[model samples]
Target: MGRIKPQTLLLQSKKKKGPTRISGTTILTCNLVVGLIVLSLVATYRQWSNRSRSQAEDGLQNLEDTDAVKDLKKFDLPSYAILNTSKGFVFVELHKEASPEIVDKFLDLCQKGYFKGMSFHRVIKNYVIQGGDDIQGLGAAEDWIMKGKPHSELAVSPKHEAFMLGTSKAKGGSKEFDLFITTAPILDLSDKLIVFGRVIKGQDVVQEIEEVDTDEHYRPKSTIGIINITLKQEI
Candidate 1:
């Protein structure tokens, strides 16, 4: 065997180093591929999560739309009512400032005798008597009452759940527009019933109104008549 030259030995060493460099390059390329795949997976998961959340929110909004605040663009104001049953006449003045659009829509129903001969649907012995539900005889003549309007801002009582009476038109069904008077003082009703207008003179007349024998549902055992309605400006 012949002895190898120094240059030949050096050339062999260089060839060995080339293979190691290629191996390192291969490892780096594999790492880069893995990183890109991880990034894509994370992005896809985030997009899916966002879509799921959006769907949940849309479902909640649909439920709310069916109740109140459905068609805000169609809100009106200045609706009023006077219930004159055998018990007596109970005049109700509405608050139109907070929801002027909703108020006007209710007033139109009252002007049409839409609530005539309706029975006091619900009455709480020392608390309240709710009449405006056609199911009890005070509801809409031909149309059905849609869900009540959700209030944007409660000027009367934040905690008060009282609503007034109104009829449902073809465009929209009137849900709630009935008056709820407070037996307590002004401060007591501050956050309960939206006290837009009080009975300035006929309050005693309302106090003297008749109350029928009620069942658990507050339904009057007999019939109650709402004779006539008169409108006047608040002083």
Candidate 2:
């Protein structure tokens, strides 16, 4: 409680000044760091959104440029045929223009040997010999493959008729490789098969498959596997 010496006073001043400068610098550094983090987050979000939008636009553009839609209005249906082993052989005229994305995906899968050695798990005589579905079998013969999404939607046309392979209902058909044939009378199906192509020459093969012994659900008793599918132009 006596008077302060000069040396003590000098030391006290030095301690106070050092701490004040350090505190100011630390506060400024923290503020700068917080601002930089917020800016980085904002940049990342904007980049992600822009990339998604760009991809969607590109997809739409591709559909617009395809030949299927351009020729559909001309009343000329594009054709395709398949040589299947179990079903013998089959031919189909495609609804190419109407469902370009879906049809292209189907055609691509067939060409890439995806349907080789795959069994027609759902073969219905009167309804459809639905195949290209491999979800059930687990044996060594099982070969599971995935096809990309398709873009085909059902449409009500004045020329609507049964037996015509139409596009799938709602937003096209499933991404899987499943296909259905028309066995219904007068083509009064509530849903349309995406008619990428029509059967032109292989109705006999379809008939042979129909003759096979089938379950109550129309699934064949013995496995009728598709050995390979070959596509070609019509004569």
Candidate 3:
């Protein structure tokens, strides 16, 4: 047999090696591409997961806020005061529209039974009738400062007209529980007093309270007790 040509031998050797090299290169390239695809998939999954978690938390927070607002809306604003006094019942309408904070404080106090069985310590005929004292003639039991902060200035201007409620300032310059109702218009006390309500019904009972005998200090001689005070919501 004739020996194979050198070119033929070379060609046969190239064909054998070419297949192995191509297979190895194809495998390496495929591995690289597969690895890149896996990494991209993982990155995309992580990003989507984080965004979903954030959206869930935000939705929960908004739901909680909405429930809180709904709960707050359940109670209507206090509109009137039904005072069961020793003399008779006196009904006063709160000026919640004008002085919301002050009226709210007053209603809160009344609801907590703070004014129950308290005496009308001060009664000045044709002027004012002051009350809401825990101890008779000793002054108010609770301080009358606004709930959150000390308001150095007034929110609403006081009009000390007949049946208008006023906050009597204590000697220490802080308003205490001493509340008063005017029998007639006295505009001079407007700057110092915070008028929160006015008597809408039962002015006769207030007049009777004003007629109660008092001493030189304007404290009542006999106990003019408040049996109870209740807040009523309009509509």
Compare the candidates by TM-score and give the number of the best one.
Answer: 3
**Clashing residue pair totals per candidate (backbone < 3 A):** 21, 21, 0
State the lDDT of candidate 1 residue by residue for 1-235, as single tens digits: 9999999999898877443345888999999999999999999999999999999999888866773554443233333455566667666656556545545655665677655665556554434444554332333311111322223443454234332322222223445455444332223233223344444345565444324576655556776546556554432
Candidate 2 structure quality by residue, lDDT tens digits, 1-235: 8999999999898877443345888999999999999999999999999999999999878876777756653334224746576657666666565667766776777778877887766654454455665333211121111121111332444223323443344333456565545432223333334555556666677667767897765568998877886665555
Task: Tell me the spans in candidate 1 whose CA falls farther than 4 Å from its real position.
Answer: 1-82, 134-197
RMSD of each: 16.6, 17.7, 10.6
Worst 10 residues of 2 by lDDT: 142-151
Ranking by lDDT: 3, 2, 1
Q: If both were scored by lDDT, which would come out higher, candidate 2 or candidate 3?
A: 3
Best by lDDT: 3
Estimate TM-scores for all models. Answer: 0.41, 0.49, 0.58
* Candidate 3 lDDT by residue in tens digits, 1-235: 9999999998898777443345788989999999999999999999999999999999987876895665554336668888899999988888766776677777777878888887887676666677764333323322221121222332443484578876644323334466778776655556556787888888999998888887776678998968998777762
The TM-score obtained by model 1 is 0.41
